[model samples]
Structure formats: C-alpha cells, structure tokens
Target: MADYKSGDTASWDFEQVRRSQSNSPARRSQSGGSGRRTQDSQPPANRRRRKKRHFNVVTYILFVLVTSAILAGVGWLLINDLCAFNKEDITATIEVTADDTIGSIADKLHDAGLIEYKWFFRLFATVADAKDKIGTGTYELSTEMDYRALIVGMHNSSGNLNSDTVRVTIPEGYTVSQIIKLLAENGVNTEENLLEAAKTATFDYDYIDNNSEDISRLEGYLFPDTYDFYLNEKASSALNRLIKNFNSKLDEEKLAQAEARGYDLQDIITIASLIEKETDGTDQANIASVIYNRLEGPGDKGGTYGMLQIDASLLYALPDHTGPITNEDKQVDSKYNLYKYAGLPPTPIANPGLASIEAALDPADTNYYYYALGKDGKHHFSSTLAEHNAFLNSGDYAG
Candidate 1:
C-alpha cells in the first residue's frame, strides 16, 4: 500500500511474479500457453480446407480416367463391328425385298454373319439418317465391305445409283404397248412376261379403277419418265416401279386440285391423254382449253353437243394405228370412238407426260371448241366450224 510517489526502490523477485501470472487461465489463454486451447489457436480452417481440396483433386483425376477408359472401349467395339474388322473372308447373298424393314434386314445380315450386332447397326442407321435409303434387290456382300460400302452397294449395285442400269425413256404419248416394247428391247424384261404381268398384276391404288376389259390395264398410269431399271429384273418389279413413280406425281396437292376441279384422277388422265395426242407443245394449254370447252363448257353448243369429237379418241381402239383416221375408223363400235360414244373414252389412250397432265388440270380460258395443227407446227384453235374449215382450206396441213 506504499505510494509510488514516495519512490520505494525495494525490488522483489520479478521472475516469480511472471511465473505466477502465467499459471492463471486467462493469462495462459492470452499468451498461448495452452491452459485451454482457443478456436484460433487450434488446427485452422484453412489447413482443413487444403486437405479437402487435395482429396477432391484426386477424385476428379480418377473420374476422368474412368470416363476416358469407358469411351475408348466403346469406340473400339463400334469401329471393329462397323468395318467388319478381323472377320474371315466370307460371302453372303442377302435379298432385301420391298417388305423388309431396317430391323428385318439387320436380322438377315446378322444371321448371314455379314454383321455382328443388329442393334448397333440399327443405331448406326439412325445416326446416319439412312432408314429409308436402302434399296430392294439381291446383293452379294463380302466380309471386306465396311458400313459405308454395304449401304452404297445395296442402294444401287456397282456402287452407282444408275450405273449398270438399263435406262428406258418412255415418250410423252407412248402407249402401254409401246412402253412394254421399249422396256423389253432395253433388256429390262421379256415382252411376253411383261405383258402378262401388267395385265394380271393387282396394283394397290386408291385412285385406280380396273373395270376395263383390256390386255393392258395400266394403260394411262405408266408415267412417262426416264427410268433406270436393273438388267433382267422381275417384270412385276419393273411395273411396280413405274406405277410408284406415277403415284408419287399425283401427290396430295394434285389430288386436292383434282377434287377442286370437280374431276377425278381418271377423268383428268383420260382428258390429258387426248391433249397429249392433239397438242404439238406450242399451244398445249389452248388445246386443253378446246378440249375442256368441248367436254363441258360454253363451247358445248351445236358445235360439239357435249361430244368431244376428237379424232385421237379413235386411235385408242386401233392397236396398229399408223396413219390418220378415216370415215370407216369412226364407224368402229368401240367405247373409245368419241364419234360413237359422245363422251370421253373408256380409259386413257396413252400415258401422258407432266406437261399434258398439267394442261388438263389447268386449261387456258377460251371459247375454242376445235384445234387443228397448222403449217407452223402450232395449233390453230377455232370457236366455229367455219373458222376450222377456213384453216383447213388455207393449206396449213395436208387436209
């Protein structure tokens, strides 16, 4: 209790005082002497976080290595089967018919040992966007062919879509008989076999009406286009291909048009056949107008009396129609003779090309009831018989 001002210089043991303060709980904690460990003086959060980071890094590396191994193994399996690698030299004759789907064809290939896995092939087909590219035919495949080669080979033989194919171009106004003759001559099929197949083959078409008693039931349906047929192919197959092409041309748009025009496909085709035989391509739409006027329009006056008196209609009855019509030909008692029938023919006389078909669907607006081939190789339409007679006497043709 002595006052510091009195300046007492008596010194005690200072080391003993420091030792006594050090033993206290508050002093020990403050000086880090470890009476009881504080939160800051214990193992730090940063050190624990560093250990966790190291563990996460190891885990990420292991994950990447496992994923890479799995990917590599998967790629090896797909490539090996896709390329037919390490396969023995083998040959398999696979017949891909029109009825075969992706699954059926894959099954066939797998059974023949030409492929290993059907599911993988289906997946490849889906990825390649070739679910509908494979064609129908008997293909000879070898173990050396890869996935690309297999698809290319089956799509069209000889690795070309049209190579090694017999190209047959049917004219615009070609009859069924002429088409059969041309196809037969081009080594597509035998004429006798094609004739029989065409007459008897039951084609499934919603628009076709097979009510006619004729040797060629597919008269007007054989769309005139350049087609590539396999050599010595099945007659039915070739016929079906032509029919399919025709069906494709008459799409939903065309069908809607026909319905809008109040005309069915048969009527359109029959009228188109006549237009194809009459028009010289210069005034086809006008000729179509003349035909429409004569059939059912204002031009159906005393000029035609709703009797499309087209001389081309008589040609349908004559199988050997080489020259122009005569008076005797008009007397023929066939439904095809417009002079006797007073309406359209029983069926289309010939297969018309797209031009004539379009003209029939969309005719030029006119009052023409007659069209004559003039000397200028163009049609000269006339609304009256006097105008037609004048053109005939004008020396436009041999008439």
Candidate 2:
C-alpha cells in the first residue's frame, strides 16, 4: 500500500523510482537503442552557435558580390561604348587571307580604326557564326558600317551594294560559256581575257579533274549563285572566287554521305545535272529515283539495261542545237550520248543547283525505272516497260 503511489510509481524508494522512469515510453523514445540524441535534443547554446555560423557565411558571400558588382558597372559602361559606337568617318582597306583567324582579323580591324576592342570582335564573330563565313578577300570598308555590315562587306562574295562592286547572278544549269558570257556582259572582265584564263589558268582545287583537254574544262565546277564582283576584276580571280564558294558547300558530312551511297562528289554532280535537264523542278526527286533505279538495272534489279537514255546529255555537245530529241539523233557518235553509253557522262553536262544536287543525293523511295513528261507539265513515272509504253501511247496525259 505504501509503494502504491496512487497505484503509480510516484513512490519514495529512489532506486525503484529511477528504474521505472528508464522503462517509460518517452524515455525510451529519446534514448533510442544506444541513447543517441537528435538535433532537437541538442543544447540550446550549441544550436544557436551553429545557426550564427551559417548566417555569417551567407552574409559574407552577399557582401563580396555587392562590392564586385559596383566595380563592374564602371567597366560595363566603357565596354558598351566601345562595342556599340565608333568615331571617324574615314575608309579603311582590310585584307583577309584564306588562312586568317578571327584574332588576326580583329587585329586588322582595330589597326584600321574600325573597332576599339579586339576581344569583343572575336566574341561577336564566334556567336554570329561569322568565324567560317568570312572568306579571303580585300574589302574597302567605311567606318559608318556597323558590326554586322562589316562582316557582310568582308564576305568573299555577296550582293552588298557598294562602290566598286557589280552584282551578277549565274543561273542554274548554265554552261561554262554562258556563265563567262554573262560575267563579261556585266563588265566584270573582258570576254577575251576570261576565255584565255579558262584555257590556261591553273586552279589548285583537288576536285577539278585536269586530265580533260576540253576547252570548257571548268564546265560544271562553277557554282551558280549571286555574287558582287569588283568592276574590271581579273578573270582568274573571279573564276576562283566562284569555285571556292562551290567547294565550301561540300562539307565533310555531305562527302561522307556521298561515299556511303557508293558515289563521289563528281558522280553526284553528274547525276544532278541530268536531273536538272530532264524535267521541270516539280518531279526532280521522282526523276532522281527513276534514274537510280535504271542505273541499278539491266536485270530484275535495274530494268533499263544499264543505259541512262537521256536526251539532254546529247544536246550538251551541240551548243546551238535545240528542240526535242529525234530517233535519228540518238545515233550521234559522242560520249555525251547516254543512249549509246552505259555509265555516267565524261563530266557533268551543266552546273546543277542545290535542289537538284539534294535530290540526286536523297532520291524518293520508289519502284519507278521510267518517267515521261506528261501534257500537264509533270513527269509520270512507271515501274514496268508495259506500263511505261501504255502511258506513252495512250496520250491521255492531260491529268
């Protein structure tokens, strides 16, 4: 009765009382299995000290950042002024070589008083993708040109309207003679000099096959594009500029893709030229597929007996000849006559545009081995000789 403690352990025996508390639920929860303490069970002074240390670290970081920002504001004003504004309205001559770097170009611009900071120019050139676009050329630049205009003015070929420049556009499928004639008429060079350069000048490009003794040796290599040439420019320089621009378009990715398809750049260009002349732009991919299917044939795989049978290839030899191909014309004894030859022509028939080149590389997935121009100004393709003959004889091609 004495140890009852109102039937609880609130009794007077100290040992009994301590033992009872040790077994209590609250005591067991705080002690856990080995009497380890949680963060909340730490001393108040120790917890406060840890919180004060964390606050000091954050405060120090903020203080340093604020001080640095204040100092950086003054530098920003100077950088902005130098990058965005300029002085002097004088003109400067900038010469960029083929192997020039952005750092070198920046140094030239700075020396010419066109830019105040070289680092800024380098940063801008990288960010704007002008690192590779700015090619070898001599540019007469005025100080009034902004950063963007300066980049454009220094490009190897462009339509930038300026003094000492004339814009000339070489269209797709134009022959070498036509290209030279067009450039001459535009006053870029004399026709006599251009012809001599075409005949004699040496181009160091690897893709130009120099074995051919044909007068128009650079027939298909001159890429078609709009260019702003200097008035009275040298014939070799103008031609080289065009050829270099063409070379730049054939990157490693495209070259690898051509190799994977078992064709070289020259072969792809030849096929593209045929496609360019075969049909209007509407059925380029389909015609490309048909050409591929036929070239793969002479059997169950390629059904056209390994002959291209293209009429346009024949016309390339006769400069003045025009009109549709006749049955008798197929007998012409020339390498350009695809009906008589089994493989690609000696060279490309004409310069092909990017669209034709793309179609040549990625032809549409199809079973077509024959195509004929319909009355609707589109090419109708067929997989079988019977279906192709039916389309030709039916003459109900209006649709």
Candidate 3:
C-alpha cells in the first residue's frame, strides 16, 4: 500500500473493472439486464397462466349472461301459463289414474284444454302444497277456470264424474223395509227390486249360504255401513256389496269367537238385532246381558217360564209402528211376537252393526233380565220385572 500525496493522479482501467462485475450472472440476475425477460417475453409457464386467466374471466362473464337469459325465459313462461291467456268457453273431461303424478295430471289438463300449461300447474300445485291432494277420478272441467280455480277443482273429488256416486249411510238398527225406503229415497234402485234381490240374489258367502232360506234370508246379514254406490245401481250388486262387507267384518276370527261363547253366527246376529233395537251402541252389552239372562232361567236371573217379553218384538210385526204400544199390538199373530213366543224371534228385526254383534258374541258378565228406556234417553236395567215396573212407574222413564 502507498500513501497518496496532494495532487497525485493514478489510473488502473476502472470502467473495465465495473463492466466485468456488471456482466456477471449473479449481477445480471439482480439488475435484470438486457438479456433478462419481461412477463410477456416468457412464453412458457407465466404466459400460459396469463392466457388461462383471461380465458376464465371471459368464460365466467359469458356463463353469467347465458344463465340470466335462461332464467328470465323460464320466468316469463311460468308467468304466462299462470295467467289467463286465451279464455275460451269449453268443457273437457280428464281422467286421472291412481298412479298419476301432479305433472302428469297437469299434462292431462293441458291436453284437455282445461289448463294453459302443465309446467305452471305443477309449480302452482307444489307451492300450494296440494301435490299429493289430487284425487284419481274422471273430472269435469271447463276452460273458463283460472289457474288457482283449476288446481282447486282437481283437488276436490266432487268436481269429478264420480260425484254422481252417492254415499248411502245405513244407520244401525234400520229394518230391511226401512232400509229399502231409504235406498229408494237416496236414488238407489227401486224398493221392490232391492227386496227381491234380498230374497233371491245368491251371495257367495259362507255365512249367507249357511242360512239361505228365500224368505227373510238377508234380514240380519246386510251389514249396516256407509257405502258409496253409483246412482241407480243394480239392486243385486248393491246387496252383494253389503253381504260382502258383512262377510269381511265377520271373518274367521269372529266366527271362532262366537263359537267359543257357545253360539253360532246366526244366534249372535239375532240377539244383536234385538239389542240394537232396544238400546244405543253404548248399552249394547248391558242389553245383551239382559237378553242372555232372560234366556238362562230363574236361578240365573231369568224367568222360570221361558218367555222374553221384549216390546220391540211386538213392533217388529208392524213395519212402521211408532210411539207407545197397545195391548192389541202385543197380540199380533206373527211368530216374531216375543209375548207369544219363547226364546229369540225367528230372525232379526233390523240390521245390527259390528258392535252389537260383538256384544251378542261376548255379553257382559251381569245378571240383568230387564231394561226400559228412561227420560234421560238411557236404558234402566233390572234383574226382575218388579224392579223394571218400579222404574216405569216411578216417572224416571219416558214411557
């Protein structure tokens, strides 16, 4: 090393030294020299990434515009279907099957010209929560109905052709003759045809076959229930429906239960008819117990003399007898007169429901021999005629 004096000058190619250091690879990399590339200059990885990004941005904008257009078109179509576009005065019938979905039903209505569009109907039904409420039937529709009206009409069963089908409710304890009149009143086939069918129509049931006497064979066999039948239906077919219902209700299990109680199906039905006439559904067992007790003898809460003085039996002889009984009424020469006969009547007086039949099959474990109607519209039961008379005269009963 040499110490520099004042005003001394030394030169050793300083610009060449700087140029060599700047040209090095490490310096070139840090300073980004002329040979270094910009983002656009590189055509391998970064350029591909930039191209991909641009393509993605353009594709996203295009996708959004296409989706928006599609949604708008669908919304317009739905609104058009829901509104009344072409109101025409026309009627159409659409048959809806059991397997028909709301969409299929809408298609049917649209094809029938009752509805404007199927898609709109499906959406409306879904929004109204009535998709599953649509019924299977032949519907009578008019094109005059609006969208909501059309949907509601389809959901209602009465809007269908099956509305002509009447609901015939045969109340319990109605006699065959009474039921005949009721059937006629409700636009069922004539009373004469119904009675003839009851007498002659052959039912394919074991219970019916066992006691197939032509006269009054269907007395206790017609199971009283609410039945749906086409208006003016065939008498035989209607009677067959009741007989089938009866056979179904009194299946093998019920028959075996009756047998276990030491009674056949006929005996149960006969007693059930009596109980049905004597009291309401609630007092069936009590009335049934009284009937059984009267049949069992004196020591068993019965009369030593075998006679069931049931007043309803007296009225059974007269088809339309009403109000209080007379002494003359009790002397009717019919075999159904309980005052003149021993044990049960030849057949039931009226059709009995399942509950009465059940009670007859399984009577309550009571020793009651008599029952009378009271002012409270309930049966006042007693073990003897004396107590029965006391209740009758004590003014506690309507009679």
Q: In terms of lDDT, which candidate is strongest? A: 2
List model 1 lDDT by residue over 1-399, tens digit each: 755732343334566676688567777668556466666655578779989999999999999999999999988878988988888888998887767888898899889888888899888877764543466677888879977777766763312223256788889988989989998899877898788778776666765544543555687799999988876665766777787788888756775887787778888888889888888876778888877777776543545866787887787788778877888888999988898877788788889988888888888999788777767777777888887888888978545
Q: Give Cα-based local distance difference scores for all models.
A: 0.77, 0.78, 0.75
lDDT of 1 at 318: 82
Per-residue CA lDDT of model 3 for 291-351, tens digit only, reads 8877765644434365778887778788689878888888888888888787889888888
Q: Which has the higher TM-score value, candidate number 1 or candidate number 3? A: 1
Which 10-residue span in candidate 2 carries the lowest summed lDDT?
A: 155-164
Number of backbone-clashing residue pairs for each candidate, in the order shown: 0, 1, 0
TM-score of each model, paired residue for residue: 0.66, 0.60, 0.56
Per-model RMSD to reference: 12.6, 12.7, 16.0
The top-ranked prediction according to TM-score is 1
What is the per-residue lDDT of model 2 for residues 52-141, given as tens digits with 9 covering 90 to 100?
Answer: 999999999999999899879857744553444546776899887757888999999989988777887788888875753565677898
